[model samples]
Target: MLQSTEHCHIVRNSEILSGEPIIRGTRTPVRAIVEMWRIGVSPEEIPQRLPHLVLSQVFDALSYYLDHQVEINEYIEHNRIPDELIDPRVRKA
Candidate 1:
């Protein structure tokens, strides 16, 4: 994994998610944390949702996103699922 100089808990590894910044030791992308926060999951509670993460890792992921909004947002936007793209089995009736 490629360690990031910008944040202690963040790293980029080409083998992982096309090198998107992720929590240092996990495949969880920084954007995943950011999106959870954006949707109103408090940082303290984030660890409850993703048990592998601790509060510090959540904060650092948020910090990394703030420091690199455009980069991370692009990842978010690019990965967003349009309504039409949702699988029929999962779409609400």
Candidate 2:
């Protein structure tokens, strides 16, 4: 594991996921957890959906999100596909 703050399970390394904050010891981005929660995935259900993570890791990801919403939200928006590029058939109403 990379050197991390004593109080949190989140870490960022330039070599990992392009330095996005992630759950320590894993490549799971904090944004992924935020997105899941935003879409209505409960904390208890997160681990079931992502078998590699535990409830604690999910919580840590969330805590990271709360501490850095702007950065993560920007990353999310930056990664979003433009509407024009979406196929009409797959676009949600």
- Compose the digit string of candidate 1's lDDT tens values, residues 54-84: 9999999999899999999999999999989
List runs of model 2 lying over 4 Å from the truth. Answer: 1-7
Best by lDDT: 1
**Candidate models: Cα lDDT each:** 0.93, 0.86
lDDT of 2 by residue, 14-90 (tens): 78878888788888888899999999999899999999999999988888788788999998998889999999999
Clashing pairs in 2: none
Q: How many clashes would you count in candidate 1? A: 0
Model 2 C-alpha lDDT versus the unseen true structure: 0.86
Worst 10 residues of 1 by lDDT: 1-10
Q: What local lDDT score does residue 56 receive in model 1, on the 0 to 100 scale?
A: 98
TM-score of 1: 0.89
* Model 2 lDDT, residue 53, Cα: 94
